[model samples]
Target chain A: MADPIHQFEIHNIVSLGSIGGHDIAFTNSALYMAIVVVGIAALLVGASSSRALVPGRMQSIAELSYEFVADTIQSTAGKEGMKFFPFVFTIFMFVLFANVIGIIPYTFTVTSHIIITAALALLVFLTVIVYGIYKNGLRFFGLFVPHGIPIYILPLIVFIEVLSFLSRPISHSVRLFANMLAGHITLKVFASFITLLGGFGIAGMAGATLPLALVVALFALELLVAFLQAYVFAILTCIYLNDAIHPGH
Target chain B: MATQAHTEHPGGKPQFPPFNKETFASQLIWLAVFFIALYVIIARLAIPRIGGIVEARRDRVEGDLAEANNLKEQSSAAMAAYEKSLADARGRAQALANETREKLNAEADKARRSLEAELNAKLAQAEQTIAGTKTAAMANVRSIAVDTASAIVERLTGAAPAASAVEGAVADALKR
Candidate 1:
C-alpha cells in the first residue's frame, strides 16, 4: 500500500533563491495558505459586494460566518472584547477555511500540523499575556491564586495553577492538531484497507466493502470535526483572551 | 545533507515534515503573509458592510414600529371624536323631542279650556229660554180656568162672575 502519510508531505513548489543565506523557497503549504487567504477574501468580498437587504444564498453564508465568529467573541469576551473582533474573526475564518478545504480529496490539512496549530496557539498565548499585563498589570499574576484556598493548600494549589497555566497553549494547539491528525490518518488507513483487501480475491472484495463503508462514515465525521476544531480553537482563544480582559476571575 | 536525510526517511516512522525544523521558517512566513492578507480583507470590507446591514435593518424595524404606534394612537383619537359627535347628536334629538311635546301639551290645554267656556254659555242661554216659556204656559192656564168657572156658574145658578174676580179667586186659591 502507498504511504497514507504521503498526503501530508510538503513539497517545495517555487524555489525562490536563498534569502539571508537561508532557503526561503515557496512551498506547497505556502501555496495553499495563499489560496486559503485569497479564497476567503474573494468569497466574502464578492458575496457582500451587492449589499442586498434580502441577501442571496452566498451572501447569507458569508453573513452567517461573520455572525458566528462575532457571537463567539461576544459570548466569551463580552462587549469589551469586541475591540479584538477583527483579529479573532480573521483567525477563525482562516482556520475554518483551512480545515474545510483540507477535507477535500488529496488536500493537505494544514491544522493537522503541530507547527501551524502551535503557532496559532502561541499567538493567542502572547495576546493574553501582553493584554493582561497591559490592562491588569501585576494583578494578571493573581490568576494563579485561587480566591478561597486555605493558607497551607494555597502554595500547592498555586503551583498546580501555574503549571496548568503554562500548559494552556500546549493543550490548545494539540487538541486541534491531534484530532485532525488522528482523524485523517484513520481515514487514510481505512481507505487503504479497502484497496488492500479488494486486491486479494472476490471474497476479499466483499470484505473490502466494510472498510469502504467505514471510510465514508469517517469522512463525514472528519467534516464535523473540522468545523468543531475551528470552533474549539476560536472559543479557546476567547476564553484565554478573557483572562486578559478580566484578570481576577 | 539535511534534505537528503529527510528524503531518505522511511514511511514506517510516520515522518511528519511539518514537525521537521527545516520547514518552520517557510510555514511561519506563509502563515504570516496570508493571515495578514485575510485580516486586512475582513477588517476593511466584510465587517463594515455586514454590520451596516444589520444596524440599518434594526433601525428600520424600530422606525416602523414607532410609526405604527403613532397611527394607532391617531385612530383611537379619531374614534373618540366620532363617539363624542354621536353622543351630541343624540342629546340634540332628545331635546327637540322634549320641546315638541311641551308645545303640543300647551296647545291642547288652550283648546280644551275655550271649548268648555263656549259650551257653558250655550247651556245658560237655553236655561233662560225654558224659564220664559214656562211663565207663558202658566198665564194661559190661569185664564182658561177662570172662563170655565164662569160658564159653569151661568148654567147652574144663572149668575156669571167677572173675569178679574175669577182670576183673583184662582190666584188667591193658588196662593193658599
Candidate 2:
C-alpha cells in the first residue's frame, strides 16, 4: 500500500534559495494556495461582472457566500465588528477554499498543515488582542474577570478565565488541523485497504467492497467536515472578535 | 512513518510534514500575500457591487410600492367623488319628483275646488229659477180658478157678475 503521509510531502516547484537561513522555495503547497486564491478571485470577479438585478447561478453563489459570512459576523460580533469584515471574510474564504480544494485528489491541503492553521489562528488572536487593547485600553482585561463572581473565588475564576483565553488560538487552530489531517489519513488508509485486499485475488476483491464502501461514506463525511470546519473557524473568529469588541464575563 | 521519512530524506529532520519548521516561513509569506490580495479584491470590488445591487433593488421595490399606494389613493378619491355625484343626482331626482308631485297635487286640488264652486253656483241659480217658476204657476192657477167661478155664477143668474165682485167672490171661494 502507498504511504498516506507521502501525499502530504511538499515538493519544490521553483528553488528560490535560502532566506534568513530558511528554505523559501516555492512548493506545491504554495502553488495550491495560489490556485485557491486565484480561483476565488476569478469566481467573485466573474460573478459580479454582469451585476444582474436578478442573479444567475454564479452570482447567487457569490451573494449567498457574502451574506452568509456577513450574517455570521453580524450575529456573532455585532455591528461594531463590521470593521473587521474584510479580515473575517478573507479568512473564511481562504479556509473554505483551502479545505474544499484539498478534498480533490492530489491537491495539497493547505489547512492540513499545523504551520498554516497556526498562522491563521495567530493572526486572529493578534488582531483581537491589538484591536481590543487599542479600542478598549486596559478594560480589555475584563475578558478574564466575571461580572458577578463572588469576591472569595474571583482570583481563581480570573486565573481560569485567563488560561482559557490564552488557550483559544491553540484550540482554534488544532481543531481544524487535526480534523483535516485525521480525515485525510483515514480516507487514505481505507482506500489503501481496497488495494491491499484486491491483491489477494477474487475473494479478497469481493471483500474489498467493504472498505470501498467505507471510503465512499468517509469521503462524503470529509466533504461535510471540510465545510463544517471552515464554518467553525469563521464563527470562532467572530466570537473571539466579539470578545475584543465587548469584553465582559 | 518518522523512520520512513528519515530514510527518505537521509540526513534531514524526521518531523511530520505538517510540523516541519523548514517550510513555515515560506507558507507564512504566501499566506500573507494571498490573504491580503483576497481581502483587497473582496473589499474593493465585490462587497460594494453586491451591496449596491441589494440597495438598488430595495429602493426600486419601495418606489414601486409608493407609486402603487399613490395610485390606490387617487382611485379611492375618484370613487368617492363619483359616489358623491351619484348621491347628489339621486337626491336631486327625489326632490324633483317630490316637487312635481306636490305641484300636480296642488293643481288638481285647485281644479277640483274651482269645479266644486262652479257647480255650487249653478245649483243655487237653478233653485232660484225653480222658486220663481213655482210662484208664477201658482198665480196663473189662481186667475184661472177665478174665471171659472165667475162663468158658473153668470150661468145660474142669467146675467154677468161685476168684475170687482167676481174677483172678490173667487178670492173668497179659494180661501174657503
Candidate 3:
C-alpha cells in the first residue's frame, strides 16, 4: 500500500528554477490556486457581463454570494466595519473554492495542513493585534479587562480571558485543519478498505461495497463541510476585524 | 504502576523522524510565502475590484431612482397642465354658447318689434279706406233716388216734376 502521508506531498508543476538556496518551485497546489483565482475572475466577469435587470442563474448565484458576505459583515461589524467586506468576501471565496477543488478524486487538500490554516489564522490574529494597538495604543490591553466585574473575581476572570484570547489562532486553525485532515484520512482509509477486501473472495468483495458506499456518502458530506468551514472562517475574520475596529464591547 | 511501565519500555518500537528546528523552519517558511501571496492578491486585486463593483452598482441604482423620480414629477406637471387646458376649453365653449344665445335673443326681439310696427300701419290704412267708401256710397244713393222720382212723376202727370223738389224729398227720406 502507498504511504498515506504521500498524499500530502507537494509536486512541483513549474520549475521557476532555483533562487539562492531555495528551489523557488511552483507546485501543483500553486498551479491549482492560480487556476482557482482565474476561474473566479472568469466566473464573475462572465456572470456580470450581461448585467441583466433580472439576473440569470449564474449572476443570481454570484450576486447571492456577494450579498451573503456583505450582510454578514454588516450584521457582525455594522456599517463602520463594512470597509472590510471585500477582504472577507475574497477570503471566503478563495478558501471555499480551494476546499471544493481539493475534494476531487485525486487532488491535494491544501487546508489539511496545519501550516496553511495556522498561517491564515496567525495573519488574522496579528492584524487584529497590530491594528488594535496602533489605533488604541496601550489601551488595547483594556480588551483583556472585563467591565463591571467584582473586584475580588477580576484577577481570575482576566486570567481566563487572557488564556482564551491567546488560544484564538490555535483553535481557529485547528478547527479547519483538523476537520479537513480527519475527513481526508477517513476517505483514504475507506478507499483502502475497498481494495483490501476486494483481494479476498467474492463474498468479501460484496461486503467491501458497503464501505465504498459510505465513502461516497462521506464525500458529499465533506463538500458541505468544505463550504461551512469557509463560512465559519470568514465570519470569524469579520468578528476579529470588528474587534480591531472597536476593541471594547 | 512503575513495574508495568518498565515492561512497556523494554518492548521495541520503530523510531520515526523527530520534530525539530529544521522542520519548524521549513514549515514557517512555506507558510510565510503562502500568506504573503494571499495578502498580495487580496490587497492588490480581488478587494479593489469587488469594492468597485459594489459601489458602481449602488450608484447606478440610486441614479436610476433619482432619474425616475424626476421624470415622474415632470409627468405629473404635464398632466396638470393638460387638465387645466381641458378645463379652459370647456369654459370657453360655455362662454361662447352663452354669447351666441344672447345674440339670437336680441335678433329675435328686433324682428318682433319691426313686424309689430308694420302690422299697426296696415290696420290704420284699412280703417281710412273703409270710411271713404261709406261716404261715396251715401252720395250715390241720394242721386239715384232723385233720378227715379223724376221718372215716376213724368209717367203719372205727363210732365217731369221739378228736380229740386225731388232731390229735397229724397234727402228728407234719407234723413228720416
Quality of model 1 by C-alpha lDDT: 0.85
Ranking by lDDT: 2, 1, 3
Note the chain A TM-score of all models in turn.
0.96, 0.98, 0.92
Cα lDDT tens digits for candidate 1, A1-249? 756666677778888766565567788888888878887887788887888878889888888988888898899989988988888988888888899898898887778778899999999999999999999999999999879889989999999988988999999999998888778878888999999999999999999999999999999999999999899999999989988998785
Model 1 spans with C-alpha error above 4 angstroms = A19-22, B1-14, B124-176
Model 2: per-residue Cα lDDT over A1-249, one tens digit each: 778887777778898888889888888899988998888887777787888888889888888888899999999999998898888888888899999999988888999998899999999999999999999999999999888889999999999998998999999999999999989989998999999999999999999999999999999999999999999999999999999999975
Over 4 Å off, model 2: B1-13, B145-176
Highest TM-score model number: 2
How many angstroms is residue B51 displaced in model 1 relative to the true structure, after the best TM-score fit?
A: 0.5
Instruction: Supply candidate 3's per-residue lDDT for A213.
Output: 100
Best by DockQ: 2
Model 3, residue A106: distance off in Å is 2.2
Q: lDDT score, residue B170, model 1?
A: 82
Deviation of model 1 at A39, angstroms:
2.5
Reference contacts preserved by each model? 0.66, 0.72, 0.06
